[model samples]
Target: MMTISSSTFLMAVVACLLSPAVQALGVLPHTATRTPSSSSSSLFMVGRASADADFAKAPLTQDDQAVDPNVYNVNDLELAAQLWQVSLSSKTNQPNRPANTPFLDTKPFLPKDPTTKYVVDNVVVQVSRTGGLGMQLWELAGGRDDGCGITLIEGVSGNAEAAGVLPGDSLARIQYTTSMQGTQSSTTATEMDVAQAITTLNCECRDFDATMEVLTSLPPPEVVDTLTLTLKRLRTWPQIDVVVE
Candidate 1:
């Protein structure tokens, strides 16, 4: 009879337990090894057996390629990573769409003819201390009394009458030139009060003459040489013929 040492018997038993045929017989493997200093042959056998089982269970493709259960191909992994990065970037960098808005019309409406037409002309007048313009002015009834229009009370002979300004004439605009501090400036007034018009004309005449005095070294008389006024007169009149039988 051959005598087997206890350690050798133990190593053989471990090898049998780690074998797949022994595992099919329902036996659990031991943790111990043979020589107490050798590599774990039982553990290596168990690992190899488990790897073989996994490879057997993995499904094969139509091309007969042995698909790995745990390993990933480097090219496939890189392509998947690139696709994921592209999808994320497209979502993050998308532009906002403009909202639907309605359009608006902004053209202005204009009239063909004006309600009133003005006769523009320049008139020269001499100013007096007692009565400036030497004309009478009246506020018209049913007129634009917001200082935009005025009626002349004429027929009295003075500087205004000499300037051909007639009675019932309507004045709508006035313009004049004035000088102050050696600077000449033009002023225009579309709306003015009777008192304000008198003051403006007087000031303009005084300032202009004073400026001329400084430039020519000779004093000019206090008179407005040119005053622009917009006058409105009736364009049509009613006529009646008289018949004597």
Candidate 2:
């Protein structure tokens, strides 16, 4: 069984956001992979717009252009919803939250160079007579490593997620072409013949000034997409609350 300790994997989820599709999907972990319903799409746009507004002032490079202000079509919104997988884990194991627990606070152990700000809303903290309420949506993944037969955390419903995804559903591959992975590709030049031809780009230079262009199939004309989301702190269990019955 795959156990999800929220604190341990939150960084991995954040790391997954580096993918261009994840940014387009407007969530951290799961990249968007479908067309969204119209209402869901509108809500996604609201959240996406909010995210863009928040990031607008950051010193980012041209690669960040994927998030520029734009209304997403159905596929974009669907992918956004799929990518927002945090809430599913939340529903399975919300702790016995104190009646007076502060909604937000800073963690000393987390990276402090540029403090990550967290905001929690519309979260349903689960209450158990024995276990109390645990923070919801710890993590999500498929049972198989090959990305098939995926299972959601138990006793969770992805539909209740503000991001508009269903729980326990297996995610298919992102409907994208991998045409950019060859030797002739300007980006990620995976050359088989020449060793010196492929030099990894500098980290700082790759961060602020990189703009890669790729040609891929668009979502079907009938599909419309958008993204809707909310967020919360990356949580860890206090020593006093770690025991499970």
Candidate 3:
């Protein structure tokens, strides 16, 4: 019944606040059970775990699915206009090209070596020159470069380029039918015969000997009415790839 000491009174107050009944009554804050530093650390850990879970599942979200991560099909016209992927070597070449390029019946015939030199006509065009055929010819033996053919060394479009001829081209077959006028034929021919007959004669590019004969027998380009050369072109093309989105 006497007055209590200040220390004893303080102990009683602390015990009451920690009691289950007082805690349930909401006398103290709910976090009061743990130390301040421990409670703050535990909340931070829970927030980090939630963030990690959300990050792990982020790929399945809606906005991330809008863009495609695969290659476009070459024939997919709807996705974009004609795009070209030019390549130097056939190993990396693709048949697709821009619309401006003429539509070819056959795929591009890229010459990787002598065996692949001859094929379909890639670019069909006629070239004409007046004087000085502007070319040098060398006889290649069969054992020299896999086989034999007449190849031009130095020339340009203005001179020896009649019938789409170009430098570094090996003569394949000659067209003796077409001329500046039209289709023409030969019955019999000699050096004294008409120039038309001489031009219409069959080409002699069959073998090295025959090719040499034809080369030696050629009248001047100014004398012939028409000339068409079939050559296997070997040149290097630059590597360029274009993509239109």
Top TM-score hit: 3
In candidate 1, how many Å is residue 161 off?
1.5
- Candidate 3 per-residue lDDT over residues 105-147, each given as its tens digit: 2123333432221112222223232333434343322233323
Instruction: Report the number of backbone clashes for model 3.
Output: 0
- CA lDDT, candidate 2, residue 113: 28
- Alpha-carbon lDDT, every model: 0.25, 0.23, 0.28
- Residue by residue across 100-216, what tens digits does model 2's lDDT show? 322222233334422322222221121111211111221233333322222221121233232233222222112221122234545555643332222121111010011111101
lDDT of 1 by residue, 106-178 (tens): 1111144333221212222222222234333333222232222223332223444444443433333333444
Candidates 1 and 3, the one with greater TM-score: 3
Model 1 quality (TM-score): 0.25
The TM-score ranking, best first, is: 3, 1, 2
lDDT of 2: 0.23
TM-scores, all models, native as reference: 0.25, 0.16, 0.30
- lDDT score of residue 215 within candidate 1: 21
Could you give the candidate ranking by lDDT, starting with the highest?
Answer: 3, 1, 2
* Local distance difference test, candidate 1: 0.25
RMSD of 3: 40.8
Best-matching candidate per lDDT: 3
lDDT of 1 at 15: 9
